[model samples]
Target: MKLIEALPIVLSCQNLSKSFRGRHKQETVVLADINLEIRKGSFVTILGQSGGGKSTLLKLLGGFLPPSSGNVLFNGQSLKNNTPDIGMIFQDHNLYPWMTVEQNVGFGFRIKGEKPGNYKHLVHEILDTVGLSHARKLYPHQLSGGMRQRVAIARSIVVKPTVLLLDEPFSALDVQLRRRLQEFLLALWSEMNTTMILVTHNVEEAILLGQKLVVVGSNPGRIVEEMTISDIQYRDRYHPDFLHVQRYLESVLEGNLKEQGDNYYEEVLAISRIQKINS
Candidate 1:
């Protein structure tokens, strides 16, 4: 999706870094000197290899974890820790099985001590946005995996946070379901105009869903490449540009792996040459 215009800034990060303790007590850096700026109402997807700092970065932004260095800012305010302005959705629904769908969606308000009568209307509205209105009374166990995920999404969005952090939230679904939910998410984002950052290893999804695509990898997870996803018309997945972006992203991801022996590097160079030729 090529952006026709520059969007307003909704979130920013500067010199963000994080590290974990290794088995030998060595400091294992997961993210290093990361910097990012997220436009309000934009969809930003982070594509990275497994064990990369993609998830860790998401957690840091969401305030689920503290960054080792640098700063995260939201709307000129320092994000020293978690703020209600940020909402998070994980791969696991994390829905309370005992709570009904409506109850789950309204849980955030409840935690803040708001009366049910005050937020009940909003809960229903957000549920409808995710196409879960009819399932409002259903428990988590009574819903399909996709439906459960929708509930999770509704719960996060009901409060209308400025930024939404998604950690491979759709990875558990079937391919078709994943695509459907992707479209749903874009639609919701359009309607709500919420800034969103998602972590995923899926190249196609990253290219198709993100206006700004970032490739991250570890040994201290840092952004290796950042590219604007232009030329996507969203008309069809089989479009030439779509396939081209996917191939490019796949090649980049393959290059980030630990097994990039000489043969692998040569293969990658060959693929790059071929893609350049085709382009």
Candidate 2:
């Protein structure tokens, strides 16, 4: 076991629920009565079906969205709005087309009106950590999908946020690329030791990246399963225990409601208030 119980609780949710008025003014419930506690410097994965409020929950946790009922606390304080202490990354890179790699990575500081002299060292350091120092001069259009995501990850961490909420940042890549980025993410997590919550529909990725796997069920989405992966040997994809866990999680996801409907997503996005690539 990792003895996470002894660690400080970096983030927590209590009786959380999110809903929004539907087209006809009916409240469409997405997530409800969800309580969670994440230890500091831990990697947690939130897994569920598509449109199952995974992204919505991530938004709530990151303070990117307000919950309908409950509260999200970071280091024991309620999150009212977005804070620099919590960084969010969407599936798309969301890098500026006009900005070069170094510029994009340095943007967190730039947004705060910090001079390049202040953030130059930090940006270059993170870019090199993600193996993108060579691409610092390249534009977003010039990078591959995996490279783009790497930049997004780099951008989020460059600020040294206490928590990094990732919303399927690796889902868009090819299988091979996805695997590579997964490895890269794990390495980043190891180096930074930041509290991370990754929302993904991929079972294998969830098991691989998370020390604790949270399986959320749909239809008024709630966490239905929580598993702690204590053994370090299970990190191997080819390990029998890893394969067994993957199969079990696949079965769990297969049993959930296949869809959350247009109303669900429509209401979700409206309430979540999350920003994406095009935006």
lDDT of 2: 0.84
Instruction: List lDDT for all candidates, in order.
Output: 0.80, 0.84
Model 1: per-residue Cα lDDT over 242-273, one tens digit each = 66557666777877434445575455446444
Candidate 2 Cα errors over 4 Å, as ranges: 256-279
Best by lDDT: 2
Q: Residue-wise lDDT of candidate 2 within 112-183, one digit each (tens)?
A: 999999889999898888899899999999998889999999999999899999999998889998988888
Give the root-mean-square deviation of each candidate in angstroms: 4.6, 9.4
Which whole-number lDDT from 0 to 100 does residue 16 have in model 1?
Answer: 97
Report how far residue 60 has shifted in candidate 2, in Å: 0.3
C-alpha lDDT (0 to 100) for residue 208 of candidate 1: 71
